[model samples]
Target: MRRNILPGLLIVLVAVIGNRLSPNFLDFAYLRDSATLVAELGLIAVGMNFIITSGNIDLSVGSNMVLTACITAKFMVGGMPAPLALLLGVGIGTLLGWLNGVLITYFRAPSFLITVATMAMYRGAAKALLGPQSVKAPSGIVGIDTQTFAGLTIPLLILLVTASIGAFVMQKTIFGSWVVAVGSNSRTALYSGVPVARVVRTSYTLTGFICGIAAMLMLSRLGLARHDLAMGSELDIITIVVVGGTAIQGGAANVIGSLLAFILIALLRSVMGVANFTAEYQMTIIGILLIGMVLANRLPLKLILQKLRPKSQRAP
Candidate 1:
């Protein structure tokens, strides 16, 4: 609960500042529309929360998203049915994620290194497949963002449903418990009969599944897929996870916190755009914020306070 306060406050602060910058900032319809834009990122962040909570990371998520999007778009443009293309994309994403898990568990190497290598490989594969070109998603599959049910966009609804399910899985189920245990201490968990390898692999695979969904949404909204799509998005995704108060090291899962953090991120970007901040400036600010949150999470509160105190008042 304490971890949620900063993001909640930041959301309010951004909204107030946004209202000052643009009349539409506080407009419900405008904000609702803006929510659609970040829905893809939100989806990925939810899965990322699972990955981090399981004590693993997937730097290849952005690449996975792009690769899935590209493949789906290519097939759709090549006259395949939209439904088939979407399923194919999800399957490919799942396979890619499973591959990452296999390599990590089999080689017993750090997930960070494994994912970093796969990240490059996946991106390269996408680039090779779609060299210097973009493919238009089929009209049948496009416009999902514009579709509404009960006055909410499909993307937003999807995010809400996914987050809700994720929250339940993380907090209530046996699988959730296993993930937490594995992340907290793999050796201990294994000794206690927990399937550590399977837990970690499942987490990564789940993240890939979510990434696939994100790719579909992105393709639907943008109507185009390129190798470079979602480039550098992993940064924002990780930032959302970290800011949501999920432990970066492992053993924690905060799905609701992640959902709220994503909203804060979306609002911050909206406010910055309304204020006419350049993309470069927006990224720089977000990067700094990510770093700050990481430090705040890693440092001990007493140590932080001690440093803030004057030398004359320092503890002996």
Candidate 2:
């Protein structure tokens, strides 16, 4: 309950501010439309939760997503079926994610450095494939943006579905437990017969697959694929996970928390945009938010509890 309070407060605060700025902000149609903008980033945030919870990070997520989208668009323009091209794109994402896992687990390199290098490499490769221009997607995919199911847009539906799956896996699966245990202590887990390497690989691979899904959604909404579809978005995704109470070191995460954080962020951005704030300034504000979260979390909870304790029950 406490974990959810911050995001809830943030949402209310943003809503209040937005109402003051624009009467149209609270309308159901406008809010639903805004969901489309956050869907792609939200998906990546959800995916990153798994990797972060399992004691790792992937800075290449933005590049991985763009690369997959670029590949998918290239195929679609080559007269391939949209569905088939999309599948291939997802497959590429999965493969890239698996590669990240393999390199990290087998080579024993730090995830931060490895992913950093791959981030540049993947983005460059994507640019090489798509050049400096936007590649338009086929009609089938371009039409996905306007798609709705039972009054919910396709991206929102997909976001909800992905979040549900993540929640289920984390709550009721052996794989989820392994990830937590590995992050808690790899040496102990390995000694206790847990397959640490496999767990790490699986976690990253899953993040990759989800990135693919997110890419397709982004492409559908934009109707064009670029070499920079999600450029530098890895920072926002990481911030979303960190702000959701996931530890950068390892262990502890909640999909719902991350989802709510994403919503708060999107709402804040919308309000800022309405106020005519520059995008560059918004990035700085978000960075400050991340730092504040980290600092507050680092505060001494025990000391606070001690201060709140009755004098009669005080310890030496």
Candidate 3:
């Protein structure tokens, strides 16, 4: 419990620092509006958490989002009904994810290398679909993120529901056990008949399916599709998962913590925005945070504990 609470405390500390940078950081409207816009990235972060917890990474998610959105846009432009067009986008995203799983498992390829290649492939395909220009989505289509219900915006509600189900699956099910076991030790999991391949495949596919949904939400919210949509988002998504206290080497995840991390990062970026920082500088700051989190794990626990202990208790 103390371990999980560490991240929560860090969130409070970051918020305090943000408020120091900009008084508007504490504004209710700023926070609420930020929460609504963050659901897109937050959704990807949730799925990436699942994949990372299962001992793999999907670098192609940004590309996956763009490709799905492009497909939906093409479908809509072709006179298809909006609902079916959106569903196809999700289905294609799942297939793309399944492709990643298949190649990694069957070919015994390095996950990092395979995903990197497909990341380009997927993004290129999206550009190919539109020939290097953005496509406007059907104007009559109402966005799920546009309205709030009972004091909660629809996109936020969707994210909460998604996270709740994900939390249950990750924390309460046999499959969750398999995922942790596989991540912690693949060979042992395979030897124990846990079907490591299936677990991994399921994780990647779930990521793709969620990205598909994210594509739908983004498409509706922006009313357009472009090959560049969500470009470079994979890094941001990974940053959220790692800073939330999930082990990069696998075996653990904190869903609620990731949500808080998303909010923390969002607030931090917004703070920088208010201070007139350029996007490049802001991303550099976040990149530093990501690296720090990864390196923090290398420190010995005794040293960390000693640093946390009172100086009076230290040896002379």
Candidate 4:
């Protein structure tokens, strides 16, 4: 409960600020549409929470989304059925994640290094495939994001459902326990019969799986697929995870907090947009937020405050 306060407060603050900036900002339709805009990032961030909780990271997710979307776009342009293309993209995404897992487990390498390399490889592959041109998204897949059910856009609905399921899995299941145990202390978990390698691998693969889904929605939303899609989005996703109060060094996961953080992020962006901030400014803000959260996690605030106090005022 305490962990969620910051993000929740930020949401309210952003909402208030946005309403002041743009009188229509609090409109239901506008908020709903804005939620759709963030669905892709939210999906990837949900998976990222799991990976971070398992004491691992994947810098390749943004690239994975682009590459998967590019592949699907290629198939669609080649006259393949939209459903088939979408399914293939998701399968490839899962396979890409599994590959990351295998390489990490086999080499006993840090995921950060492996994923950085894979991130470049994935982005390079997308660039090679498309080469400064975007493939046209197929008819069926193109408007999926615009479609509404129960007064909510399909993308937002997908996000809500996915987040709910992710929350349940992380909070209720034995697999969740395994992930937490491995993250908190791998050696101890291994001694206790936990499959540490499998947990790490699964977490990466799950991120890739979610990336695949995000890719499809992205393609639908943008009406095209290109190598440069979602460039540097990993920063925002990581910010959302970290701001949600997930420990950077692992051992904790906060699904609900992340959800609120996503809303806060969306609202902040909307506020910035209302105030006419450029994309560069938005990126700068996200960068600052990411750095601040990381430092906050590492810094001992209470101890620092204790040292700052005068000797006479300090506790014994």
Candidate 5:
């Protein structure tokens, strides 16, 4: 609890300091927009947390979002009902996720290679469907333009719902226990009667499902969809998950931490935008932060702390 609480407190502190530095950051509109952005990336990060906690990675989330957006765009362009179109988009995303799972589990392929291939395939399919064109949303989707609830954007609402569900799953379910166990040791989990393969496969499926949800929110927010949507979001998503304190090697994970991390990254981007920094510089800073966190994870900070403890207080 202390570990998780500390990161969130740090995020709040940074946000407060950032807002103080730039009064615009405290503007209701700016904060709302930041929440929306965090929600989008955070949704996928939550699923990634589950996957990482289950001892695997799903690199196909970006492509999955693209595919979902493309499918929704195609349906909307063809004059389909909005609800039906959205449903189709989600279904397509889930199917793609299942495909990833099947290949990785049944065929015994490495998850990294399988997801990488699927990522290309999914993105290629989106491009082929849309072909360098973009499509706008049809009429009647809520909050596409000129609306707000309690000063919060609709996208932020979506993000909040998604993150809440994710937190619930991680902290209050048998599936969560299985996820941790699988990450710790698949062999031991399997021997203990846990369905290791099934758990992993399900994680990818959930990843796709959440990406689909993000796709809908993004489409609604932008009022348009393009094959190129979320072109480089995979890196951002992974960075948020890592920064949230999920182990890359897969054992422990922090869903709430991932949420806070997403907010932190979004705030940083917003600050950078306000500061008029070039996009390249912002990316460089993010890259540096990612490297620093990775290095921190690898270091024996725990052992060092133990060694530094007072002799009287040290464990026997």
Candidate 6:
């Protein structure tokens, strides 16, 4: 609990100070918009958390999002029902994810190299599928943007539900335990009879499913889908996952921590927007934050704090 509590407090502190530093950020609209942005990114970050915790990474998430969106646009343009289009998008994403899993598991390839290659392949395929033009979703499907319940945007609600389910799966279930075990030491887990390959494959498949969901939300927000949708977004997703305290080397991950990190990054973006900072500055800040968080995770700060406390007050 301390692990979760500390990072959460730090995130809140950053948000409060950031708002104070930028007067334009104190408004309700800014906060709502920021929340929506975080939710969108959080959807994928949660899935990435699972993949990373399983001792793997998926660089094709951004491309998956684009491909899903392109497929969704094509369906919608063909006058298909919204529900059908949505399902097709998710199906396409799941297949892509399964392909990744099969390639990595069967060929004994590094996940990093495999996903990097798929990332390019998926993006190129999306561009070819959608051609050089963009497709706009019908006004009815786009109307989801204006729909809300309980003071939350529909998209935000979807994000909340996805995060909640992800947190449950990663923290409370047998599968979650298996994920940590496999990630911490695959050979040991295998000796203990855990299905390492199955876990790893499922992680990638789930990641693709999440990417599909994110594509729908993005399509709603933009009211249009293009081959370039979510381009280079994999970097942002990876940054949030690391910033949230997920170990880059695999072993342990914090779902709530990743959620807080998602919020922090979104707040940073909102602040940048209000301050009119260049995109370069935003990227630089994210890069610095990622490096700092990774370094901090490697430190024995807790042990140092224990040492600094008064001997009389310390636990025996």
Q: Number of clashing residue pairs in every model? A: 0, 0, 0, 0, 0, 0
Candidate 6 C-alpha error for residue 179, in Å: 0.7
Q: For residues 81-124, what per-residue lDDT tens digits would candidate 4 score against the true structure?
A: 88888899898888888888889988999999999999999999
Structural similarity to truth (TM-score) of each candidate? 0.94, 0.95, 0.93, 0.93, 0.91, 0.93
Please provide, for model 2 over 114-191, each residue's C-alpha lDDT reduced to its tens digit, 9 standing for 90 to 100. Answer: 999999999999989878899998877785757788887889888888888887888689887888888888899899
Model 3 TM-score is 0.93
Q: Please tell me which model should have the higher lDDT, number 2 or number 6.
A: 2
Looking at model 2, the pairs that clash are none
Local accuracy of candidate 1 as per-residue lDDT tens digits, 239-267: 99999999998898899999999999889
Per TM-score, the best of the predicted structures is 2
lDDT of 2: 0.85
Q: For candidate 5, write residues 171-256 as lDDT tens digits.
A: 78988889999999989999999998898889888888888878877777777878877766777788888888888888788887
- As for candidate 3, its clashing pairs are none
Candidate 2 vs candidate 5, lDDT winner: 2
* Range of the 10 consecutive residues with the lowest summed lDDT in candidate 6: 1-10
Worst 10 residues of 3 by lDDT: 1-10
Candidate 4 versus the native: TM-score?
0.93
C-alpha lDDT score of every prediction, in listed order? 0.90, 0.85, 0.84, 0.88, 0.80, 0.83
Query: In candidate 1, how many Å is residue 90 off?
Result: 1.1
Over 4 Å off in model 3, which ranges? 306-316
Best by lDDT: 1
